[model samples]
Target: MIDEVMFMRHGRTAFNLQRRLQGQIDIPLDIVGQWQVDMSGFTLAQRFYWAKVSNIARHPDRLSQPSDPPIRRSDITEYEQAPASRRRMVVVSSDLFRAQQTAHAFADPLGLDVTLDSRLRERDFGQWEGMSREEINERYPEGYASWKAHEGGEAAYGVESRPDLGKRGSSTIRSYCDDPQYMDEPTTLFVVSHGSWIAATIGNLMGLPDSQLDNLTGMRNAFWSRMEPQYTSNSVLFHLTEYDKGPDVADAVDWENGPAYLRNPDMPMWKPLI
Candidate 1:
């Protein structure tokens, strides 16, 4: 029962810095990107560690012995010493170099291996793969205009359509969750993929209409979104619980108190950041 899926966008690349369409170009992360990965990775690992502790604290009956002492700071070290299987988490990534690099940042600290899936690759930009948005607009005014209007004009230029990209991305994620190996446990899947692909997949998972797709904006580099399954009578649907979260937000959390602190009934619930 894959409990949750964390879809993370890879770190910035040279092409990202230059505002060019990388598509499937296999770009590597730049210096800033590496730093982003390092910080976010550390924060991610810390959050996971604390989340495990929180679960134990919430369900003490699950402890090996009823007389076991309350969770303490030393539990962190104990967790690190535990076998990887005890973590109940898996890291997955697009086969692209950038995505794989980002995935490793989270996997290495968590002592998990990354499972690569080529289907998670970024949408093929085709003729505009290496071009900047400005160049595309300048070179193919009509197509660019049509694309901006959400009229599927880019298909004429050999670009992958949004529907096609969404299908590919959503199906790839579904396959992983449906795998027999992951179906029985409360596992968390960390999927590192591309910006466009992530957005499209999320939109599909949430069953967003084409006219409503634009309501969900693109994700920034090194940021992530968390989704949990919401089982309906007909099928299971993923609900977007968090979006565009990153190290900055994680750093702001009150780690000493844990995530539950944020759910205090007296605490004012804030709207999601733009």
Candidate 2:
């Protein structure tokens, strides 16, 4: 059974810094984006190790007693040395360059390969692909207003509808869960994608209305959300557990408008959560 799915947004890009719509454009990560990926990747690796240890500790026959010693790094090391088949976490990413760059960071630490899926790409922004918010507002004021209102103006501009993007993302994830190779294993699937896609997909999976989804904040670069599957007799439902989690320092500031601490190469990487 695929128990957990994590959706991660790719690190910042030149277009992201310039506040331009990248859409399906093949943008590479900037220097700062590379730094963000390195930090996030290390933290994610720690989380994977900790989760594996916790699972073993919670095993029916091996439950830890109240007096048991605290989990140590040695314990995690031991778990890491276990057979590969016993640790079945799969990393999947959008085939776009930025997403693939972010995916490799986390995958490399776990000695896993990243599986690319085109369906996970960012929403097509059409003619507005290279435009910044300011440019869009200046060139297509009415369409911009309509888009802000979540009306149908975006259709005229050839942008992918939010609902369609959600369906594409959600269905892509569902297909992986239903695959026979991973169906019987307690697999953890990591999907490295884009901000809008992640948000839309989460809203769709949770069966939330567009109005409710509008209230949810967009995920920052290199941040991730986690969902766990709840299996019923006939269907599977995913429940959101964590949202927009990343390095500890990032928790306090909105990177989009805040100071450029993440851009500093000297900034210390956060210690592992585990």
Question: Which numbered prediction scores highest in TM-score against the true structure?
Answer: 2
Provide the overall lDDT of each model, using Cα atoms, as 2-decimal numbers. 0.78, 0.80
Clashing pairs in 1: 1-183
Cα lDDT of model 2 by residue, 2-31, tens digit: 889999999978888777899999999977
User: Candidate 1 — worst ten consecutive residues by lDDT sum?
Assistant: 254-263
Q: Any idea what lDDT model 1 has?
A: 0.78
Candidate 2 stretches with Cα past 4 Å from truth are 50-85, 251-274
Clash counts for all predictions: 1, 0
Q: Model 1: per-residue lDDT, tens digit, 1-274?
A: 6879999998877787677899999999876567667677888988876444433444444345434567442344444444532447778899999999999887776555698989989999999998988899999999999988998889998899877888898888788777888766577888999999999999989898866665678997788899997656666789999998887654765322225533456533322233
lDDT of 1 at 15: 80
RMSD of 1: 10.5
